[model samples]
Target: MKPSTGRQKALAKALTALIPLAPFSDAEAIREAAGQRKLRELPPSIAVWIATVAHVRHEHSDYDALLDEGYDRDSARHFVIDQMNAVLTTWRATRLVEGDEDEGE
Candidate 1:
């Protein structure tokens, strides 16, 4: 619902950072906390996945369906956060990888 806390802010920041990379990152937290249960992590790929799914499919209910797909309560929550942050981390890694490519070019 409302990201009213510092943790929420951090999560939002992380998610935003991870968006550009796409097809990578973690995105677990963002998935679990879709309804704002806890802080959202959300990797770039998952972030894009969620956005694309939302845009193409149900609109907004994709996250809940995803959460219920397999993850238990804690597992879903933790994994969502981890996955999202992982996406962010992966995106940074991708940038580094691309930078290396440019250097070669």
Candidate 2:
């Protein structure tokens, strides 16, 4: 489904500032996924967050392999949290802090 042009444009604008550290291809993929979520009526920020995390989980972490190995979803995600956060740091989506709590899935 086609999201409204206004929302698309706005999302693109937000993403430009949000993920300046991301490579062009990664940014493009995130934008496309976020746009899909936006079409489902999620708020742009929420859509972007979901898309970004999913991308990091699938592309930059061992999440899928862990799942394939019979780990439950939460357990797999727990194991991959640090890897996911590292990717988010590279993308400028988050920063590491000493003593910071886990960012829940």
Candidate 3:
């Protein structure tokens, strides 16, 4: 295998630090995915965010099944927002949804 690029190594380190509460297998998988060629083009923070959100959406929520059941994309996302946010909270990542009082901030 090719040696990892500096960007890949840095992204992996950032992801590990960002999601310390995530399970070992999940955390490693997210880091591996974030180091992919496409994601490496983005800023590390944004890549990490995307990878984490995707992991939560697919693994921690019913998003795929909702889509399979014919829920529209937006509606499926809305239905799983709470479950997604709960996983985010557990991992100490920023929650995607906010309460009304958080809106003005």
Task: Give the 10-residue window scoring lowest on summed lDDT in candidate 1.
Answer: 96-105
Best by the lDDT measure: 3
| TM-score-superior candidate, 2 or 3 | 3
CA lDDT of 21 in candidate 1? 47
lDDT of 1 by residue, 38-88 (tens): 213644344433443232222222334566697564443343443444444
Q: Which structure among the candidates has the greatest TM-score?
A: 3
- Per residue, candidate 2 scores C-alpha lDDT tens digits across 43-73 of 6766666677778788989999999999998
> lDDT of each model, Cα atoms only?
0.39, 0.72, 0.73
Error of 3 at 35 (Å): 1.1
TM-score of 3: 0.80
RMSD of each: 13.3, 4.1, 5.2
Candidate 1's C-alpha runs over 4 A off are 20-105
Model 2: lowest-lDDT 10 consecutive positions: 96-105
Winner on TM-score between 1 and 2 is: 2
TM-score, model 1 to reference: 0.25
Residue-level lDDT tens digits of model 3 in 1-105: 222888777777677667768887888777777777778778886677778777777899998999999999778777888998888778886446543211100
lDDT: the better of candidates 2 and 3: 3
Count the clashes in each prediction.
Answer: 21, 0, 0
